[model samples]
Target: MPKLTKRTIDATEPQVVEFFIWDESIPGFGVRVMPSGRKSFVVQYRAGRRPRRMSLGPSTVLTCDQARTRC
Candidate 1:
């Protein structure tokens, strides 16, 4: 997968099913693209033995760099 840069995000068109594009550089830092074409920043991490997902905000509200450093 490509790095989550502004260009990458813009180039990634939403698909029929929602999917996540994780940043290889920052483990869980990534974005979620809904089937509706909505995009949001997301951070995934383990809560105890189980994993969890958190939505930071819409992609319009946070930049890739901001999302990367947030989690």
Candidate 2:
């Protein structure tokens, strides 16, 4: 996917099924487009072999830069 930018995020439309658009530059940093048309920033990583996913917040409340920093 392309770099996660405000433009890209804003341009993303929700699919029939929920999916994620991952950041090319930052591992685990991505945006989730839900079927309900909700977009959210999230970070996925492994914590001691167990996978973990954390929602940073809704895209409305967080910027790409802010979400990247959190990751």
Candidate 3:
């Protein structure tokens, strides 16, 4: 799987849906977009045998830049 780059995030509904449907190989990132058009970032990765996941918090509360820093 390729490393997730900042350029990959969609920032819009149509692109977000396409990303999930088309990009299934990448293994380090997930997203939660809100009805108000806010997006929350998540980190998904494997640590040894277990799958590790972390929530970077809500987008409105934490900017996209801030979310990346948390990861």
Model 2 ranges with Cα > 4 A deviation:
none
lDDT per residue for candidate 1 within 29-51, as digits (tens), equals 88899998899999999999999
Q: Which pairs, if any, clash in model 3?
A: none
Off by over 4 Å in 1: none
2 versus 3: better TM-score goes to:
2
Q: Which candidate would rank higher by lDDT, 1 or 2?
A: 2
- What local distance difference test score does each model get? 0.88, 0.91, 0.54
TM-score of 1: 0.92
Across 1-71, the per-residue lDDT of candidate 2 in tens digits comes to: 88888999888888899999999999898999999999999999999999999999999998888888888
Which RMSD values do the candidates have, in order? Answer: 0.9, 0.9, 5.5
Query: 35 in model 1: Cα distance from truth in Å?
Result: 0.6
Structural similarity to truth (TM-score) of each candidate: 0.92, 0.92, 0.50
Looking at model 1, the pairs that clash are none
lDDT of 3 by residue, 1-71 (tens): 23333454443464334232112444465565555455667787789999976767754576545665676
* Cα RMSD, model 2: 0.9
